[model samples]
Target: MSIPFDRAPTATTDTQLSFDSLGAPLHEVTFVIVDLETTGTSAGKSEITEIGAVKTRGGEVLGEFQSLVKPEESVISPFVARLTGITHAMVDDAPSIRSVLPSFLEFSLGSVLVAHNAPFDIGFLRSACERLDYHWPQPTVLDTVTLSRRVVGRDEVRNHKLSTLAAHFGTEVSPDHRALSDARATGELLHRLLERFGGYGITTLEDLAAVRQAGWAKRQAKSHLAKGVPAEPGVYMFLDGTRRVLYIGKSGNMARRVRGYFNASENRGRMAEMITAAQEVSCLPCAHALEAEVREIRLIGELAPPYNRRSKNPERNSWIVLSDEEYPRLSVVRSTTALEKSSAIPLGPFRSRKSAQAVKELLDTLYPVKRCTARVTAATLAAHRPCVSSQVGQCGGPCAGVTDRQTYLSGIADLFDAMGGDFSSLRRLCTQRMTRLASEARYETAAEVRDAMRSAMSTAARAESAQALRAVPEILAHSPGPDGGLDLAVIRHGKLAAASHVRGSRAVADSSAAIRATAEWVPAPGPFPADTDSLPEETRVLSQWLQTATLITEQGAWSLPRSGANFHAQESGTVRLGDAV
Candidate 1:
């Protein structure tokens, strides 16, 4: 659904589905009010003694389903006989549960199942389906007990228990611990609750589903915040009273998506907090889902909205940069701007600074690369002495003048080759080091070596993927739009430069031509292009889009590395491309 950006959607809104658009009106919905009398409380241990249901629509009775199910193993206790006026003798003549369950299921098919305490009755029915090997028609369920709690205040009804509600509502049929009587009472309660919900504009089955949600009143009251929000694919921002953004999200349907935040459909605890703090909902509608996603990523990165857990600080991500110096060394940096300043190749824009450091360590371990932080030059190298690392053979010690500049530089070249997806040397060295360490019983050090090796391999894989697209000077691609038609995008050097949405074959061609002509001029990217602004994420977004996109035009070779970052140990010290080992 990822499409180009900044274009007015050509697809008509009428065809787009939303929550309200799909719900069945309450009056049109058939509700099967059911009640079950069981020998015990637990569905696993209990046996249904009787099944009763009343199917109704628009307060009119459509049909009634009732059956007495004789228990196979257990008989009703004497206390239950006094409550329901039924016992083993009474159910002896009745059909067994296996014979009665199918008929009851058929009677309630295609209807929203309702019960006074739904879980108990529905659980028993579903459990019966499992035992009897009958396919349970997983119908929509409505619990009058939940509905009454939301509709009738505690002041009006002391408790939501069936007997309490039946008495409070003065039902024609009072619940008497019998299936038929309780079901008839529950049917009356359903209608009364529906009437109450109508006052709050809960006119459809979807609305009723939210009645059971905690903070139903608060959600209903805040529903107006969604007003005027366009029903289109877009990014939404929930702002607090001071107009500070509390949350940012994207959805195919902006209005419906935002509205859901104030409804039962959204149940995330942090979202509930965000909704409570939110005083206004604003949106930036897009042409399609992809544009929405891109905008969302960019916004989250730029704003770092507190509620958003991902992509908060694209700037905070760490990268392993090859330092631009007389004696080059690996260093961890926060921005890709270092790429523009130095002849350094960026290895990653890893989410964790620790992971980036791990890659640096892995590279240093495999190659006798410099580990010193001091800035050294040819002038300073003659005055320097061999460091501790040089004595231990971990570093080339170019600063000490012991290792010639050319020899140290040659080692760096091999290190760069490994970072550039040729992980053969790194794999072999780590494998040998790990085997040697385990033999010496240095298990923890071996584990550290393994982790560093993995971190390095992952960084290499990502760099390979990104560089493949960055090498392409230009690419024209199209994907199916959200509703209908095509989404055309012009990509330059792995960056989205222009995008448009159009309908019909003629319009697609026209838009494509216009987008290509008007596309922004982009210079060819440097090796290991930095993650400044949205470069890395945008490339990732484009890569995903191109995976399924139809290419109409291209410039330059857009080739990925042979194995692309799937580095694994292979025979003869060679590495195989697959998942990293």
Candidate 2:
């Protein structure tokens, strides 16, 4: 989820550009430091027992509101009673939440709400408002915990808990879980955070809001590294002083994105560390976002940058392949090198082992293929006994000579057909299993079966898409660019050969000619383009984009397969994979 900071207002008039953009000054803004003692941690299940708030402006205390609220629908748990020192006897004569909430709302009107852990307190208040049918005045909220992390380094405190922060800042009041004392401590901590932020140019609420979501001083200190970066759609590489690439990323606006890393918007801790180590920014301007994305994937796959988490190990992608034995069984393999030497039909280039295993499990459950690992040949059938899977009817009894070689081969052919594109067999079996599971009220297991079926279909669809693209020798496609022009790409085989952006209708023809002339030469790929330098991920990326693109020209066959993954059903929530096109 993105940060919930109040954004700077857009200037509506020429005179509103300068001082108005800064927002309300910190000292001038009315802030309500609030705290609540609750029955339990869960806002949905708990009730607030006490409320305390301090209204202040310009370092002067305006007023303090404190109340012991009687619970309407809940009793104070023994643990909470001891923690907050608020027993049932103490709040028995106190007012209920329904009466006290309205007054609290009136007291905190038109002010920024401040709390140590704002979510916990705000969640309880919102839940109360919802339960009591009161219109919640949605006030701007600030969490001192979030703000403290941005300005206060770890050297000063072990953690950003309320007690830790209050002690670190040497506040006059120490938090002891009582609502009023905690509120006072939180108010003091908020002032200290503001004081620390003054050197980082956080004088206004707008500045505070922008930096609240990220580390302030570290990013501000490294802001100059992004100054030389260009403003264009492209891939960027952040390098250390010795010129080693530390991180790789792609964005439409390179300058703004790079600058964001040095600002309060980029909150990722790893990214903050990368920015600190980065001394130089290198850019590779692309024709458009598509080219930038494709280039980024290839670079990450090749360079294996330490900072990039994904697309770095394309070679480690696993695939589910059927064994070439007489009684074929499903197995997951990483190297497609072995499949080249055997007649085993490969079903996937699945990104994760778990996905490939899920598909394998689904196929194993659907078909009566052999589940045992023992190589059951005609010569060894006399010595083999039926395995547990065969006894349970999950596998054909090929080892006990119950299933003949021709029959087993026929079943293997059907399995191969299902893996190729036809999902009828798997779909029929999965539907039955799901129905049975649903009847038994095992909805989670049914959902898992549903997901596995979807994954199987998706794997088949991906393979077919790649095969169709590789079959086509050449394809030139164009889409309406973001800048009101044409974005054209030259695809050879299944790989992106070249990309170009034409700014006007008149330049389309000339740009196309130049792009085609300068395009990389890609030979006719075989059944699979696994040997190609580009990752299969790149082809998958192009496949998604080409679904919406207009084909200006093409050579050889270029069409979506008749059968594809249909996870969505037009008629009902339950997927009828058998009816999928």
Candidate 3:
């Protein structure tokens, strides 16, 4: 992908001179207004017969370059002669294009070049440079046509053509069918356009570039608000003039994400308007993206910023609850309160009903958790006929009295164990089945079973851990931090109760009381994604780290890091828990 000339000649050219001051004063910038007359429209098919340039600064012309270039085309087309008034006889005595290209390149060096229709002029020059192996410097280019389009309304000027603008501005010189005359007129037009550019804050060379950039000038006025954002994993809030949160978002690098709001690539008009309205930006640094993500979700649910459109409908969240019947059937429901009221085993805070359904379907594919929605007692089972699921062997057929209530309940307990984060037995069984299927050349079936098993494992682990954390009355834990310190956190019913950091020799002892976090701002937590996504690939790191997090219970007894929560899978010879959001 390297270009033939990514860098210019360092020894003789001014290309290496530093110009870090993209915000230099307007008078300091050198404008090399250039124009070209060619034999035809396209550089690939035509040859440059003449090049004209006028370099200026502070409304004063510093130098000028003009040349007639002879091409290999011995005769000019009648149309080209009539248009540019340059015939073959005119350029016959002129030097070849290769000889004139170097002078023009040198004249435009270390300067912002201006042309009426830049691509036409610059394309011709670039073609000559490429053909002759004369490395062209990457020069700053300004198009007068584009500048006029930005500065003058169509109602004021009929068009941005050189003749039309020259007449409209009343410049001393006018563009003719000649290179030098047209270039001089275009240069005057450049000065006129620059005079009106102040309203756009186009005081710098970069500012000049932003004028023609796609919607970039609109964002320049407010970029200072994001300058203070830190470059680390965090949550950012955009605030309006009234200090109300306009948007809440999470990113691994807060500064970078905030800066993206000012970029031209943001295609959504709503996003653009939101950025324009933003007057201040705030940041909340996090341990990692996970903490930021959870905090963002909770905050959005709490603040309900108008610009944030997703994860705002917690009322629509679904959970998988095992119905409390003699023949319990796995089901999906929508309320968090149902967990305590129904006395049924609950396993969710799924983002959507579709996700809950997918997890349920995956579980059913691996384990026959009776797909029938029927309520069953021994009498009811004996009286009713089995559904098609029973005939197809997808269900255990407890409704037809084929399997007794106790055996069916035993299966339900197994389902509970499988869903509650105890995945060792399921893994061993699925592994055996997958290996056997592969050996029998049923690769597709093996893949299906393997995928379903993995999906169920992830879902169960996520739901069970989240459920277990939520069910806990209170717990506290400490982890090592930078510089021989400890970071302490208090957990109550799944969300943080308090958090703090202690440094130096008093770290361990002071952490219990120095803790500084609260659940007041933490929105009620439940139903989080365990393993459903990736953005920039670092998303799962925090999740994997949180899986086996140790907790000190309120009763001073250790349930996790002591007795298993059963929500962990056996990997190799070790138990690994699910990733959290």
Candidate 4:
């Protein structure tokens, strides 16, 4: 007589099944071992070539189901056919996905779904379900791969592949890599794993279903985020499984940053750690820089992200200015408060103590201002000798304590003048010195003054370069043509350092606005020049063309090539050499 594959009848007698009676403590539990042969690796366009599943409960084999499905796409690859032994002719008469998916679903029901690398199988199943508009509520998914990893440890298991696992478990796997044979081997492997590692933690069907659904959702979300992220300004938030925010960050380009998280091979060490810990990702888009900044601050405050607390703290967003008194001393102060208190005075807001120190060092190098310790009075100064700064004439001999209050106050005033963004006074001083030297017929001294002036001007030029580069505007023009196009370049020291191809008129306008907004900013060192001659011939030629033909600027530069049509002088855009690229 043929064995029945249908569901067994439930007991009508009123006897409850206890955990012990159900064989809860036993090494073996029910599992529906599953495997699929597919046309390709990608689930998006690929179709299943074959399907196989075997149901077992309490270490007893119950039933088996297998079928070959005709894939909708034409031409199975030669390699795929060779590996699966399922040729194009064999599946030509087989049912389509619509006809076969229901049967597979029915067979997989009421048993834990077991597979090696469950993600691969589930991904394809989910994709197929989506395409067919079928609702295959996730079954309890038990990945022997994950179980083996846990039981054998990652380092000890050189190969945890299905065939490897079958071999390791001493099960002979015939027709390897094919769906039905692989499914049978997986069933045997599951039996050995349960025996070796104790019964799976799965209990209720609902419990298994919940775990499977959650895992599926996570995988789907990750895949969607990876493929669907937009390349635009936005803020991203990372959350744990409990939905508690872990980190928040803003990027001018969102897709690139999102992709960075999924780049396993390149960022394997870091990504491996992050992916295992990360539960979900959330993102928000911002239309502009100010909008993005505001949104970021508000979300950071609302979420109280653990990693962004430093930026959110009011105390950390402060500036410190050294007090100018008989004893000059460092004063801790808030940026907004200080800016409000002394609207006319110059102050520098620092993000950290290290930043503050760096600013102080820059001030000392540029201005050589006095920074004597507060404790040193005239009497104390007389007892000790002068410090190195005083000896070098960089300091006004504050250690000697001989200078009057007025003179010290005057020096402070000079420092304040320099810090107030007023270089005119320094220019006047150099001019006066040059005039005096010229009157004495000292051409050499005059030349030295000229060199000093160039040096000073270079600083201003560098500041302009920095400002231009920092706030690059959106491209205003986007078409590829001669008349309405803008050539952009990032110039350093009169040489083209970097170049970009921008065509949209709107992009040009946006980029111009961005550059203007950051015109006063200073450029940082190590900017890649677009017009460097060291590059390939074509790149070098392009760089030179952009540098000489296009308007160059310290901040950034742009120019629209002259269109052939009659262009009024006022209507025509003029090119300036000092614009940022």
Candidate 5:
């Protein structure tokens, strides 16, 4: 009787899954041992005089096929005839090469092929098939000579030739130049080589094919190192004996990804150095691919592993934060701490500080906002005269009371609107200024306007990316696990607040509990205008995941801003905000 249980499963190991799941057991693989006695060596010049084959599986012989085919040549070579002991009369009345091929191919249609040296036999077979308009069955082929070299080693065996290896392995059938005898010897040699392969953990045709290269065979023992890593989506770290991280990476399958580094075909220069230096591998399981990706970046920035070339420093981030003041002014700030406490509208997590500064400069020229930092009181505002910025018409002159508080605040309000993807006023002003400068032969001034316009649009795009995620109040999403189960995540207030695993029949209950646990939990808004490193680990991880999440509720869907990049295209005529008094 079979019993069903709902317990969560432990992680699957390398031995259980192996390199990849083999479609069938090795013993069940059908093998056709083939030997061809040709008139001479080269398939282009020589013709096959005899064909012999034995089909077997798991060391049991299933069938045999033998044929003597008449060559196009009138007589065989004296040396070949003597070596193979096949006279001309033996094949004189036999079927032709074309006629004999169909019967042999039909016998071995679905079998793996084994030969002393496969290329020599396959070449002759392929040549005949090509010449006669016959389709060659592309069977899985193995070369016993190559296998013998790996199995017995050059030190143990005199040579890899069929006759020499056959005697050494003590096969039941001895090798003679005759086709049938050589075929039987090869079949026995194949079984012995396969048994030796088992010692190296090669059981299937894929394993045999993989280990054919000396590089693969040399690293076979080290392949077990992959066994320690679990198969799941997460960040993997390679560390040296001193416990220092050599390299950090993320993948959908941590075990599979780590295993690939040790593969024979690995050709990266730094990868070789990392592999040799690394003594242990560490993994941190993530809720999903997005979390894994963010964690990878976070780790690189925090540790600054020498092998990592990207996202090494989170401190390099920049943001355009609207100031928390009576007369608000947009300023580029690198301090995440100042941003979060200022209660200002934070519009980035930009890649660089210069990019944030560009947008700040663009907004300042596009809108008539006060720039003087002196605390503004009705008494102080009336007594103070305008600064040079006011004289130049760069500001509305709020400090001099030339502009009323409500009037100046209205302009500041418009700046906030511009930051939220409405760039109609800014675009019009920038284009008009550019056209006027170009018309007056001030080409450099025109280029500056053009560049500022681009910076404004690019900044708008980055803000759009972040705001879209914030529109969703909360999300409960699940991603598929390696074992037909789900990895769950709970994002509250647009930040990944909690994550857990639920396998089998407990998905619904566990998912609800996970969301409820974080219901009252408000993740910190976190230090803004700073690099990825300054953000709380939970916020960084969740923010990345939410970027790609599918919001569940209609409230979440309809909450997003309807405007896009096209919203900026609404400004058609050139604007003269810069020249306006």
Candidate 6:
């Protein structure tokens, strides 16, 4: 026979009822081990089929409460029924959750709640409490699963399951799988775990809770420190309080390397500047440290994070092209133009003007071309004032009207063709020059031509190789962020390499801002531009690296191309006075 309850009674409506029965406490501090058999995993769609509790004190069972709940849901799954042995027919006449919850709460008074995977049970209970318009006071819930993991050393136990724990402690558990039976078994398991690990500073319930809460973080930090992240590696990301990925980087020993960011006195100032801007740290732990280098390069090309040093301006992100007009004048144009006009004939989308000019000089040295800014026009030639290039014989005196327009155009066309993926033209020219020089016994000239040919071939080959690099995963482009400007930086191993800055329109920006406000950014693959032969080595390397590296951005889905540099222009419009422009 069950013990009679002695607690104040409460009035109830047709849908609400109360039960007040107190169970005995366990240990110096009492606990109520509780379990619930639910209709389904989803608390919203399902209802509790059974509720069970066992209260104990000083290693002795004081009292127990069990009830079958008639759920509002019309049907329960066969699997749930079999697992709990609580069929719909059996619970058809049973009390409702609203009628049973109060009774359970009364029995659980003056006791800390304990269960295996406490969140699973507590989550359902909390949901029910919410539906009943009751603010369930947050209880000091203990999880037997976590306690077992802590007590039985995470690695030593193949499984910390209830049955396994019971077997391990040689404690007999009857009527297993039922709510009341499981609750009793859990109570026993907790007793054994507490006794075993109690000597190792797990004496108090609060101490155990703290240990469990910090379990994963402590374990990971220890592992990272012990392994000693190497210095010869690639990139890393520094995340902050908001879990916002604040920075991406490449370095060997990323852990030891990143310590510098936090170790200095200046760290607080720098971190304070970025912390409110971030939350939750994460990284791509690479095997080969150099993989970090490669990853860093890929990341910069892709994400274009704000903190990276690369230019965020789209207009500045351009390439040098040799124009197709007569005399083949060199021109600086946006990288986006190269994607639109296939015949612009590019030399580079180099990181800087200096790098682009250096490449131009190298090309000029290998293949003789006019380097002067002087225009070779009919009027200028007729005037007979030989341009500086003509005086130096570098221009073939075209400005002196010595060359026809047809010839000038042809020469310009040939120059562009040779530079634009026509390795054979350059190769043929180099070979012819080498042959002529060799025939003249000018071996040095022949050697120079051969070396130039080799470099040109290598440059061509690299470009072709870059073309073969695969497109990034489609899901990557869907990263969550507001339509406000987003800057992504790609770091490989540990070096800053590539970056992209994206701006969304007001409409799109508004949606993205809403997502950001809620802090619901889900990582997605972003568009990674491909490396073209016309792009400089640094840009190419950065582009390829960005393809593989981690991306961090605010929330929005704006389509961008996978190759060549291009930035979306924010549509021009005037804001009205009420718009806070």
- Highest-scoring model, lDDT: 2
Clashes of each: 1, 0, 7, 40, 1, 78
Extract clashing residue pairs from model 2.
none
lDDT of 6 by residue, 310-383 (tens): 42332354455665545655555665545344344564334456545544554565443556666767678779
lDDT of 5 at 153: 75
Candidate 1, residue 409: how far the Cα is off, in Å: 6.2
Candidates 2 and 6 compared by lDDT, better number:
2
Put the candidates in TM-score order, highest first. 1, 2, 3, 5, 6, 4
> Of 1 and 4, which scores higher on lDDT?
1
Give the poorly placed runs of model 1, Cα more than 4 Å off.
1-22, 210-212, 324-329, 337-344, 361-414, 428-455, 521-523, 527-533, 563-581
Top TM-score prediction, candidate number: 1
Write model 5 residue lDDT over 422-469, tens digit each, in one string.
Answer: 766777788788888899999987887777676666545544444444
Q: Give the lDDT of residue 200 in candidate 5.
A: 71
TM-score each candidate: 0.84, 0.68, 0.58, 0.34, 0.57, 0.35
**Residue 180, candidate 3: alpha-carbon lDDT:** 92
lDDT of 5: 0.68
Residue 208 of model 4: what lDDT?
Answer: 28
lDDT of 3 by residue, 290-333 (tens): 45665676567667798989757555667777766666777788
On residues 115-198, what C-alpha lDDT tens digit does candidate 1 reach at each position?
987899999999999988899888999888788877788789778998888888788998888898889999998898888888
Clashing pairs in 1: 566-578
lDDT of 4: 0.53
